[model samples]
Target: MAINVELLKKVCEAPGVPGYESKIRNMIIEEVTPLVDDISVDNMGNVIALKKGRSDEKRAMVAAHMDEIGFIVTHIDDKGFVRFTTLGGFDPKTLTAQRVVIHGKEDVIGVMGTKPVHVMTPEEKNKMPKIKDYYIDLGMNKEEVEKLIEVGNPITRERELIEMGNCVNCKSIDNRVSVFILIETLRNLKECPYDVYGVFTVQEEVGIRGANVAAHSINPDFGFGLDTTIAYDLPGASAHEKVTSLGEGTAIKIMDAMTICDYRMVDYMKKIAEENKIKWQPELLTAGGTDTAGIQRMGKSGAISGAVSIPTRHLHQVIEMANKDDIDGSINLLSNCLESLDKYDWSHK
Candidate 1:
């Protein structure tokens, strides 16, 4: 089936900066509600949906975080300029002159401001821009800005998802794209052998906070983290350092900074993909992590864990890109794995 670009765009553009994931949470809840047997939001604002299996003998949790890397309003200066702190990881080079939305009492428009090149000293032009040196300009004076905006407000990039050649580009596609894949997988499942829990987690950008709580409460027998893996197939990156390449296929994690995937789970997914003709690629991210790391060691005896990742380029940037084919492949492989869980043995490894 062809992936829905419009739906993917809507999910990516929806505001959900770390702790403030209500809007994206609600959007996911609506899409997943009909696909699962039951659904509700957990204490940490995770949208948990359950699809009962034929026997309920085993429980499987599939996690896809809804939160995105953004900024929070830290202080507002007298000139209506706002100083902000990052809510998640960011590359300092990507911040200059980017458009952003200051999610205050009402949404306030702003732009990351910097000294114009015309007035910059030669030394300043040679040096890299610092996050500390930047502030947001909302085009309003101190008095007017104070009455409408305040500290602790969330901020997001103001880019819409768009299709270019063979890729889809947008903000928050890091994990929101994964959320879309998981929900679509469940929607296509005819039946499941093990009880399935589709968890759209919150606060992942801050520190995998929501998944920590949801895993403790549900305590599944197995877990699969659906997320985006870096695709470093760009200029100035070495072949060895490139984690995965765009359009290759869905990425299966072997290891990352935060988690080492279960060997058995990885093998199982690879076998299923080969037998079922689903395309896939192996990934080893040297930096960063995903909810899989947290969920793997979260419960009574813990759970066998793995991840299905969409290959992405320019991750954490406003115009992150991914291949449509890889997304469909991920959905297929994930759904097939969930359906065939009864045939696989988990206790041994």
Candidate 2:
């Protein structure tokens, strides 16, 4: 079965930033509960769902993070402007004039404002904008703003998912798209050899906190991190530097900054793709990491780990784009991999 675009849109637009993932976690639990044999949330707020296999010995863990990059209220100025700190990695260039939702006592709408270019000097224009130079304007007086918002409330980009041509664009597609894929795969698994653990992790944007704990607890024989990878296949990018191209296929990571994929697992994925005629590309990311980095080293001796990535453009930005075919292909490949896991000799190097 293919991923439902409407469901994908909802998951991408849900408000969940790192530690503040209760909303998104609850949504996932509702959709995934019936398909899996059991499900529960852990202390770190990671949602762990299970689908029992024919045998109980071999287990496979598939993880996709639910948190997205956002901000937290740091200080409220006398004039009611809110100063904030980023909760995850962000480019200052992408902050100007963006709409945001401050999850205060009540939802507060705000806009990120900066000095107008018309009033700036050439030197000022040449210098890059800094996060410190910007503040969220709620258009309220100091007293009113103070009454409505606290210093610790989370703030997220206020953008809804839109379908453009053959792609889907949204703010939090970085890993929510992966979550959709994992859920769809489990729904499509008619029969499998090993027990499957579908984990929707939290705090991955800040650090791989949820995956670390989940992996250590489950101790699966194999693991896969489902997440998005940068697709630098746009204008102004050199051919060799493009990490992976959009619409090509789902990416199979050879190695990335955080994790070196197990050779046997990589080969296993490739073989399954070829046998099933699913489109795929080999990925080698120069920078950035995913939950795979944390899962590959968790528990006793660890499990052989690898990742299946969707090609995404403008990742971590409001208008992230991904192809429909790539999303469908990833679901097929992951489901096939789960069905054939017990057939492989995982202990072999």
Candidate 3:
């Protein structure tokens, strides 16, 4: 199956920082409304879309977070430079020389600026960069900047999605790509044995807040988290360091820093992928967690949980990339898994 690059592009480009996810949440609601039996937004802003199954004896929840790493305006300097604090984790060096959009009264474009290397002393040149050292230059004086910008505004990376070779690259691919995958899965999934709750969650980048709330309410029996995983298949990485590789097809999460995947779910996913002939790889990341952690344990009685992880390169940076084939495989795998949940045994091995 071919992935929808246009939809993926729109999803990846939309701005929705961790605590400020209104923009992306609205877009998700619009796109997913017609594809499910029923949909509603929670008080916490999670878009829960339910696709009724053949029977409601069991419930399955799948989470794809809509929030991305971004910045919140802290202060404006006397010369019009914008000072901000990160809304999520960031590699400090990635902020250098990047363009960002500040969602103030009006959208304002700014370039991240720091001291020029030409003027740096030897100690400064050798030291690693820090977030405090950067400020955004909006090309306007203080008076003009104050007219349109203020503290508390959300700011997001300003990169547009584009196809490169056989992959798509853009900002926010860390979790937005999974947003695309979940939307597509909801669109393609057929009748299943249990209700399928496709939840486009918010504030996942900050602490899995949205997924935690949704899971508590739904208390699903089975769960799947849709998110991207590291793909350090680059030049300097050793074979063992490559947690996953692009174009290796969708990844079946074994474990990560926050949650250890249920062994039963892992076996079920692997069995399904092999039986369906979907190419897949195992992901055992030692760092970073996804909404899976919330879905796995937040529900009453807990849930058997695993994750479908898209292999992403340059994760958390503006140049995040993922293979189109891998994305399509993710959609295929998730749709099949949701539709065939009744075929598997729930008995503990």
Candidate 4:
């Protein structure tokens, strides 16, 4: 089945930085409301949707964080330059000459500005740029800028979602694509063996904060983390360095910097994918983590946790891309896994 590009586009373009997710959270609530038996927003702003299963003896929690990497306003210089601190990890080089949207009293567009290479000294030309070296140019003086923007406003990349060669590209695809997958899975699900808690969490880019709170409350027996992983299938990448590849398949997470997936959960996911003939690959990211960490260890006794990772190119940048087939396969795999949980032994070897 073809992925829903329109819905995916809306999800990717929405602005929702860590600690501020009302926009995306509201969209998620609307999308999953009819698909689930019950839904509610928690105090921490995580959107939890419940779909009852045939047997409620065990519960499963699936998390797709709503927040994207962004910046919070810290200072506005006299020249109307916007100085901000990053809310999540970013490659400083990506900020060069990029456009951004500052969400303040009203939405305003600004351009990322940096010292031009032509004016740099020989030593400076050879040095890599840092986050501190960049600022947002609002094209207004301090007086004019203050009317629309101020300290504490959030800023996000300004990019529109576009389809290119069977893949969707846009900002926030790292996690928004996963949010779309979880919503679609819920819409397509038939019967689950255990109650499914589909959670659109917040603050994942910062520290997996929302997932920790949601998982603690749900205390699920099984957990699935839905997020994106690097697809370094570029010209210069070595085979080993290509963590996963675009259009190859959805990735079944083995381990990342912060969490080692439960061996049983990993095995079960692999088995389910094979049984259903769903295309998949193994992912072992050396750095970076996802909500998987929180979902795995936050529960009272901890849950058997693994992740369904979309293979993304140019991750954490405005041009992130993911294949349509991989996205469709993810929705299928997750829906099937939720329905067939009762069939798996889930025993330790």
TM-scores, one per candidate: 0.98, 0.98, 0.99, 0.99
Q: After superposition, how far is residue 121 of candidate 3 from its true place, in Å?
A: 0.2
Residue-level lDDT of model 3, residues 218-242, one tens digit each, is 9999999999999999999999999
TM-score of 1: 0.98
Cα distance off (Å), candidate 4, residue 202: 0.4
Poorest 10 consecutive residues by lDDT, candidate 2? 340-349
TM-score of 4: 0.99
CA lDDT, candidate 2, residue 135: 96
Per-model lDDT:
0.89, 0.92, 0.94, 0.94
lDDT of 2 by residue, 13-113 (tens): 99999899989999999999999999999999999999999998878899999999999999999999999999888888898999999998889999999
User: Which tens-of-lDDT digit does each residue in 1-349 have in candidate 4?
Assistant: 8889999999999999999899999888888898999999999999999999988898999999999999999999988999999999898888899999999988999999999999999999988999999999999999999999989999999999999999998999979999999999999999888999999999999899999999999999999999999999999999999999999999999999999999989999999999999999999999999999999999999999999999999998757999999999999889988888988888887
Clashing pairs in 4: none
Per candidate, the number of residue pairs that clash is 0, 0, 0, 0
TM-score of 2: 0.98
- The candidates, ranked best first by TM-score, are 3, 4, 2, 1
Pitting candidate 1 against candidate 3, the one with the higher lDDT is 3
Candidate 3 lDDT score at position 295: 98
Question: Higher TM-score: candidate 2 or 3?
Answer: 3
Q: CA shift at 337, candidate 2, in angstroms?
A: 0.4
Residues 54-149, model 1: lDDT tens digits: 978779999999999999989988788999999898887888889999887788888898889899999999999888988999889999899878
